[model samples]
Target: MKSAHSSWETPDPGYWTKQGYIIVRTDERGSGQSPGLLDTMSRGTSEAFFDVVEWCSEQPWSTGKVGLLGISYFAGTQWRVAARKPKGLAAIIPWEGMSDYYRDRVRHGGILSDRFIDFWWKNGVQPNQYGMPGRAARKWGRDTIEGDLDKATLEQNRRNQTLDTVTHKFRDEDYYKTRDYSPEDITTPLLSVANWGGILLHLRGNVLGWMRASSEHKFLHFIVGRHDLPFYYAHCARLQRSFFDCFLKGNDEDGWKSGKQPRVKLCLREGDAGVDDPERELLFPHREEIDWPIPDTTYTKYYLTAEQQLSTTSQSNVTSFAYDAMEGKPLCFTHKTSARLEITGHIVAHLTVSASRSKADASPPSDIDLFVTLRKLDQSGNEVYFTGTMGDPVPITKGWLRMSLRKTNATNPGHHKYLPYRDYFSTDVEKIAENEHYEVDVEIWPTNVVLESGQSLVFEVAGHDTQGVGKFSHEHPEDRKPEDFAGINSIHIGGNHSFITLPVIARG
Candidate 1:
């Protein structure tokens, strides 16, 4: 839905129209034929979306009820718009879309996710600008109905997301605050679908959105596969139609009619289902839960041993592991188990960490970038990868944090031991000093995987991204300058700073 390119067909008209639905897609302001300022995720864009939904609900051909559904950009906007609670808005199906713009898209752990922003701007936004010429020739969309704007006017009207993201580092800044809204305000009937492999982006936001929304009729469902394919799958389509049919059309072929359906439905990932294998996906096991976090989920801590091993025993001893900030290698600790352990729900890592000067360094770094990865290995010891966004192989999950941005908002209602919440405000920047140990918690993205006997789990911490980052990378030269982030990083393993909390589900 980037710029609503107009030719993108993930909506599948044949599928919706045949179900007696009128499919209406818009080229939102400054996208395609619409002429105005081109601000992708600002409050202005959300207001426009809110207005358009109300407009659709008022049309003479309308049934006075409207349900919102879309993937990626289209889906991400739904949370903000639905929070406004416009007239006749009935339900929303935000499949694989992020709800939090700051946490999910622009910044990862307070670090600028500049690569994806630049890539999206050039390929997704620039070509489809309101006044761009030759759009029809390029097959992007029809050109501006009003004569194209001059280069100066065009440049002045749009916000460069990459530039704005780089310029603003904290949530309190007007740049991000203008885009922020409370998900708790969204009371629309909702069915939010998350992807296990959306490690670098929407995974965390989707899960949080479902939890924070005020909708009594909300449900959280999960799926696996490439980004665009799963949304159009027959089974997923049936699920969507059933949800909207019940809420918008006053008919429920499924249990949604009486709201007796489980609030959480999950795809159980036990082994390597392989990437984008649609046939095998249908056979994956599933579980239905009346509440998330499973109620019986025991938050167990895994400690780091002197030998860099992860264990359940309380091995109390001072141990240190160091990695070169610029060396591009990570310190890994693996845990192997013989019992079936279903690790689901929220995950967090507690570590006593510090930065120091390496021999190759001219000066010590002022902060550390902790890139954490949780991985699964088969019985024979080969690493197992799951289907991530765009069908790439990713680890079980990933988390990130900057030592300077390690301050936690413990007073906030959303903060919990299972998930360390941070406002990422300008005031939360606690700069690191050399040789001083500071305790920090990193919020890993939510995941679901059943560990079979002899399978292993590995947790990694590094000064840079390890793997499965794809285009959503934080490699902007300004944000991660060598002088500020390149030196030596250390993890103090013992007591409160050396363990990861996993949501261990009791096997039946």
Candidate 2:
């Protein structure tokens, strides 16, 4: 479903016809010329998707096989349609579409991306900003639910609601019922292209979908740049054609399926870092041995020293940093410069901390999100940056923790290290040991950066928002400061609990 202003435009139905393929660009239920309430994909929206695909298959110009294209919302409907398994459906090229709607859309690292989605709906999808040209009138459409079911205006719409009203139910029934997809029931072939630096709503879902989907033939590709950058121009279109040609038209799998099976892929060295240069070519794609969590990685822990040091030793009950709210100092952790090192994986911080308040207002048994950034500085003290197709600097890997969502005590010691404390929500935050040290695991986001030996690796522990990385932005123009951001809490760092774990890749 192309938005009114989205550059989701195609090269005309003639292009597909020339290739002996038929293309049908119908206004999905409520949006364009179609008559229906503008309910944003409630239960009715999923049904509408099924109807659209089925309708296209029944057309005389069609060959009874339907495949989906486009990005963002274009890839979104695939979740619902694929889950239903329409017989006429062939394969899907879901460009950056992840299966878990909740994780990709609303929340990450247990923190609600309070600004991004609502902002996108208000500006991008609903209003079609960014100067992209389109003809669909940008207006607030109707709701499919709560309206006359048999009338022409509401018939096409399946639900009468928008995401703005249903933000409260991440773990509840409202959004879950409509947004959730049954990965087990979807067996169709899929080609999911993800963007490494897609801060808004990319990367994570692509990784999860490629791993979780029941589809036997699934290919995962990663590009670099802004979330929607790949959709514009001809690059994304050419790749989409290759995908549909192989799956929809029964063409030979030449470009679509070829070469070194890359499970985890990255678009190579891209973008200008801390320097001004005319942005280079649009994109560069790279492949990896494993899909998620990176492959062939040697996971090593970098211990924190009491005297503000980073070491590869287990100096038990040693490292600690003072993290007071008003006078907290930013601690620096560094390793000896070696050869050039490229660290590409997730970095986790396993810390035991104590707070000044026995019952702190800010550090409640709630899942509190803290920001962790991995940076590199050259010998001359210059910060290095990376850019790719999307024309944006990318972060390696990121993680989250809910103060109350933490789970530390597992009977199995082997599994204790890999416990579910990463971001899985737990209800009992109040029961954790009070006025004492408790384990706090801060997960850094995934990243792909190259650092030289003479240079240093820096990890920063911050409580408020840092604009350089993920989508959680306090200064986002559309975002009004929410209640959570206003709260303040102080972290106590001591010998028993506070250190950053680094996965150091030895320099060659």
Candidate 3:
């Protein structure tokens, strides 16, 4: 059900047992001790998980009230299973898990995130696959209870995530469509923990789940620190225990039954803090709000000027900046902060752009891949970085878009200010005619940063990955052909054609 060898960073059984609660650890189908066709994240696997949760409700010694809790893959499964509305499922805490497979994991803004898919398949998923040879000797997990399958059988037993990811380009594909679910169907009482540092994969899903799930008791808590460590933090554990105790045991000691608790709790990244430093990360502040993106957020726009600058007023003249579609430094614009302020929520960039042939004889590129980065700079013009998933000092946030999939779903209810929802389906694809300027809105992942009076922001536009992508890159050759995506990309910052909409919290 999950990719982490079914170890899942599950907490000690003895601790919960001592609290008069029984904890059951499961090696889901085709993982750990369980044996079956290995199809991680497949619909069939999720159905099996649904059966298990229902069975737990029928157990004689069980309270008939089940609470699901885990990290990453384990957490991600909670969302899918809960969507089934399994009987006796009381509550869930999906810590740092991705909800949308296509948008969050396989593809980013429509580009195939093949690098992370390859890395995760080898390191996190395949090695722990049931009956994988040498799992016992190499300490991946216990040897299979049954005799291990042979080489050919092993290869045939599992779904190849890498191959499938390459094959499935859009959400409408059978491979991806079958995995999709409505977040509103997840009606379980939920505590969805999102990590701001998990910008690459887990961050967006967690936020979206919190925003879209129909659970009235659902709460969104944004934490800071390593994904591995934050979930087990003493404060986080206390939060989990209180939530579970209220729902599972009928003990509402924390007033979770009523509206006493804050629906949204956010970890404030105000000043400079080192990546992966838990002590310093916890040193940051915490704020309570009623909703995600804050209801009163002032979505301010920073205009991309013809002078190749980020300004408040648009220049009268038209202008454009160019960069090699498959190479070269990103074009950047800076805006110095005049007052101390905090920007904490979703971010979106509006751009007018086109692709073309590099030379007279070269062929035109029919597609363009746009990579945008929002970086923080100190008063002295030095760059500031936040903690990335791998401890890499990354920008405040990043966004991407494949030019052909630039059509926005404005009619959808989810589409709103500060965020543009795009259906990355085959039918949603727009023809990217060469040299035709198209206006598109790029959805940036949620982020948080408090800037001092002199601190500034750098808005970077590029044709390829900038800082903070880490191992999750999109460089698949067939998917990004040179003739279709490796030419010249130009950003037309004329009038209102190009600008970035930043989420600003208005201090009342």
Best by lDDT: 1
For model 3, the stretches where C-alpha displacement exceeds 4 angstroms are: 1-8
The residue pairs in collision within model 1 are: none
How displaced is residue 355 in candidate 3, in Å?
1.1
Give the per-residue lDDT digits (tens) of candidate 2, residues 348-396: 7876654443224644321234555666667876656544224555444
What TM-score would every model get versus the actual structure?
A: 0.97, 0.76, 0.96
Candidate 3 local lDDT, 155-228, one digit each (tens): 88889999988888988889988898888898899999998888889999999987889998999988877767
TM accuracy, model 3: 0.96
The digit string of per-residue lDDT tens for model 1 on 353-378 reads 88888865378789898889999998
Q: What is the TM-score ranking, best to worst?
A: 1, 3, 2
Segments of candidate 1 deviating more than 4 angstroms: 1-10
Q: Weakest 10 consecutive residues, lDDT, candidate 3?
A: 1-10
Worst 10 residues of 2 by lDDT: 477-486
lDDT of each: 0.86, 0.55, 0.85
